[model samples]
Target: MRKKIVAGNWKMNLSLEEAQSLHSEINDALETSEFNCEVYHFVPSIYLSTLLESDQKVNVGSQNGYPAKNGAFTGEVSMSQLSGIGTKAVLIGHSERRQLFNESDILLKEKVDAALEEDLKVFFCCGETLEERESGQYKQTVIKQLKNSLFHLPSKEFAKIVIAYEPIWAIGTGKTASPEQANEMHKSIREAIEHAYTQEIAQNTSILYGGSCKPSNATELLNQSDIDGGLIGGASLKSEDFLKIIATYN
Candidate 1:
C-alpha cells in the first residue's frame, strides 16, 4: 500500500524560537494521537537540526536544496549538507520557487538527482497556472512538468519520490480545489505516471494534494482513492489543525 504522508511547508514563516515552540507543540500532540500516517515538516534550514533533536515523530525536510553535491555556489544548500543534518526529504520546485526564484524544470531535475543521490526522499511538486487551468491545459501542463523534471530518473530511484499537485490558483488563495476536482487531477497524474513508468510504480507512488489543505476539508480530500494525503500549507502551522488533518487517516 502507498504510504499516507502529510507534509507541512512552513514557507519562510516562523522565527527560530517560534519554530521550536511549534515543534514542541506538534510533538506533544502527536504523542497523544493514534494517527499512523507519516508526518513531515519542511522548516527553514536553520531549524532542521533543532527539530531533528526533538522527540517529535515528525520527519524533518528542507524547503529547498541545491542541485550540487559540493560547490562554490554561494547561498546554496547542498544535498550532503542536508543529509548530514538528518533531512529525510526536500521540497523541490514549489510554486513559490518557480514564481519568485524562476526555478526551471532543468534546475529542478538536477535538484531531484542530487537529492536522490544522497538517499533523501523528494517531494516533487508540479502544477498549472490559473490561465492553463482555465484553458483546459492543466493535465498537459502537469504532464510536461513531471516528464521534464522527474521521469528521467530510474524506477528504482523513483520509488523514493512523492508527488504533490498544487493548483497555482489555490495555493494560498483560500480557494481550494474541490475534492472531485482534486481527485480528477490526481487520477490524471497517476495515469501519467503509469504511462511513463509501470503500473506498479504508479500504484505504489504516493500522490499528495497541496494548496491550502486544512482540517475543514482534509478528510474529504484524503479519502479519495488516488489522493494519498496532503502537502499542507497554512493549516500546518497550528498544532490542533495539523493533528486533526492527520486524524483523517485514522
Candidate 2:
C-alpha cells in the first residue's frame, strides 16, 4: 500500500519556546495513540537542531534549502547541510516559495536533485492559482509543474518523492476543495505519473492534499480514493488539531 502521511508546514510560525511546547505535546500524545500514517513537522530552519535533538516520534524537515552543497550563497542552507544535521526531508516548490521568491522550475529541479543526492526524501508540491482554476486550466498548470521540475528524474530517484497537491487558491485562504474536486485532481496527477513512469510506480506514489485541511474536513478528504493524506497548515500549529487529522487514517 502507498504510505499515508500527515505533514505540517509550520511556515515561519511559532517561537522557539512555542515550538518546543507543541513538539512535546505531539510526542506525549503519540506515546499513547495508535495510528498508521507517518507524521512530520516541517519547521523553521533555526529550530531544526533543537527540536530534532529530542527523542520525539515526529519526523522533522526544512521548509526550504538551496541546491548547492556548499557555497558563498549567504543566508541559504544547502541540502547537504540539512542532511548532515539529520534532517530526513525537505519541501520543494511550495506555492509561497514560487510566488514570493520567484523560484523557477529550473531552480526547483536542481534542489530536487541535490536533496536526493543527500538521500533526503523530497515532498514536492504542485498546484494552481484561483485564476487558473476558474479558467478550467488548473489541471494543465499542475501537470506542467510536475513535468518541468520532477519528470526528469529516473524511477530510482523518483521513488524518494512524495507529491503534495495544495490548491494555491485554497491554501491559507480558508477555502477548501470539496473531497470530490480534490480526488479528481489527484487522480489526474496519478494518470500523469503513469504516463511518465509505470503503473506500479504510479500506484505506489503517495499523493497528499494540502489546502486548509483540518480535523473537521480531513476525514472526508482522506477518505477520497486518490488522496492519501494532507500537508496541513493552520491546524497543524495546534497539537490537538494535528493529532486529530493523523487519527483520520485509523
* Reference-based TM-score of each model: 0.98, 0.99
C-alpha lDDT of candidate 1 relative to the true structure: 0.92
lDDT per residue for candidate 2 within 32-60, as digits (tens), equals 88988899999999999998898878999
In model 2, what lDDT does residue 249 have?
79
Predictions: Cα RMSD each? 0.9, 0.6
How many residue pairs of model 2 clash at the backbone? 0
Backbone clashes under 3 angstroms, per model: 0, 0
Clashing pairs in 1: none
Instruction: State the lDDT at 142 in candidate 1.
Output: 95
Instruction: Name the runs in model 2 displaced over 4 angstroms.
Output: none
Residue 28 Cα positional deviation in candidate 1, in Å, after optimal superposition: 1.6
Worst 10 residues of 2 by lDDT: 27-36
